[model samples]
Target: MDTQQDWDIYDVTIVGGGPAGMYAAFYSGMRAMRTKIIEAKRELGGFMRTYPEKIVWDVGGVGPVRCERLIEILEKQARTFDPAIVFGQAVAGMNRREDGVFELTSTTGERHYTRTVILCAGRGMTQVQKLDIHGANRYELANLHYTITDLSRFAGKRVLISGGGDSAVDWANELEKLAKEVIVVHRRSEFTAHERPVAQMRTFAKVLTPYRISGLYGSADRIARVALTHTETGEPEEVEADEVIVSHGYDRDFGNLVNWGLEREDYGVSVDAKMRTNLPGIFGAGDFITYGSKVRLIAGAFNDAVLAVNSAKMFLEPSATDMAGVSSHNERFFEKNKAVIEEEKQRQQN
Candidate 1:
């Protein structure tokens, strides 16, 4: 299945198709730069697609839009610039060559040689961390879902969400009106979510005491009950529910770019305000960069994309003479690849 290819040169190559990467592509297009977006998954909108039904509480300037709604808007804006996007291709390795260009190798064995590399790949390919309870695996592909991709299906059903972070609270608020009953389970005494959302959830849904999910009980095929154990007293209880939604955050492992030897500040790639990494042509935006005042919101990522694109543009054209030609070439590339650039999707049904 590997359609391996040699290095495809690009002005900027953005890894990960999340909000950050999407905006990066858009900004690159606005700057008239030849850019390519590579996403591991078949679809765009990385984490946004993971919880399309949940309400976005953090995106400032936009009032509590549904995750899927934001994805649609961002995807549309990203495509307006007309950039080549490759799906189902995960970045396997990246390195700065002696010639000052980045050599990026994808998991599918495709090569991309780019003048600048922007790592907007937030959370580096996130997946739900599941609780390995008995009977959980059987329902995973059916009634049970680890991440809240669509909340409409649970409109009238009783749903129990596990986790205390912002994600758990976001779902609780988003599905309170949709679901018949929403119960939040947190292992700690205090909520990890923002104060406003926590207060809102208390008024709408039932916030459970400090407890952890013990196991899941089911009937012939679907989940029927969830067992919980109190953190302090160790008291056990069982609750009947129609669905179990686990929002216990995600595990981020950047083994793909670990060998690049880039400077690390607080376990992330060190970057300036323009999202430029320690390496001359390498930059990291979104949640992948290390900085004192870093914002991980979708809007913040978009702003970062602007800065990174501008820096990349200047880097590409150190002299003012090449600027006009670069812009013209990028415009031509975008117009020619309009059909091939947009609407690239891959699906995995296993």
Candidate 2:
């Protein structure tokens, strides 16, 4: 079948639709390159989707807004130039042809052609860690939660959270006021969370250290109480709970990407100051790649995207401008600015 993907070879293709990938797409357009984004998930936002209800205030100019709202705005900006977006496809292989175009093949056998590739596969297809206790899966739909997507669901209910990491402590502290009671169970005496949050969590939530959820006692797929076992003493106790939250963390894998020979560390793949990876024509950005003084925040990802996109442009044509002009100097950007102004004016008039 003849398709646009078959005939059109993008100048740059971004793998992963996180903040880095989204900004890369927009910046590539400013550099006048045909761009495409390949995301494994059905939607964008990458790891940010895990914390939709969380309020984000650190994305540079963006004010305090829900993570979900920021995702919407980023997606809107990513589509500024109408780049091709391929969803539900993970690129499992990359091969550069003699013609100089890179061929990317997904696990589903779909393929994309591009001149340059930007690796933005943050955490490399992260999978949420789940409860290991027997029959725990049965109560997942009833009350068990791996991540807190909605806060309203726990209104005025007894909530028990497991683990001692930042997420566990943070959630327990937040749930203290809303839930009838907040119980935090950790297997270690010392929590791995920040000292300030841990101190705050101890102020309200019922903290149990060196303990574990040995068993879940529930009826008909609903947890009524949880049996706790002390790791050191083996003493057992039980706590009643209306809801159970596990912050066991995630199991991340780069899948076949690790075999591509990109220099990587425990944190992520290695990239130079210019965001260039070990593989030529293949750059990286976001938390997927690490460098000296690299920041893991959303603002950091945007900065990396700009550098990677500019490097990709220069790689394609050495004579191309070192950087994209500012929005004021970009001639075609005026239409979008005018449209935004008009929309704001309309809102004001209404």
* Model 1, span 223-342: residue lDDT tens: 889889999999998988898888787887675676677787664677887678877887777877767778777777877777777788888877523223354456545664655445
The C-alpha stretches of model 1 lying farther than 4 A from their native spots are 1-7, 56-64, 203-207, 320-350
Candidate 2 residues 75-140, lDDT tens each?
A: 999999999999999889988887788888898899888999999999888888887776689998
Residue pairs that clash (backbone atoms under 3 angstroms), model 1? none
Model 2 lDDT, residue 167, Cα:
85
Candidate 2 lowest-lDDT run of ten: 1-10
Query: How big is the positional error of residue 205 in model 2, measured in Å on the Cα after superposition?
Result: 1.0
Which of the numbered candidates is closest to the native, going by highest lDDT? 2
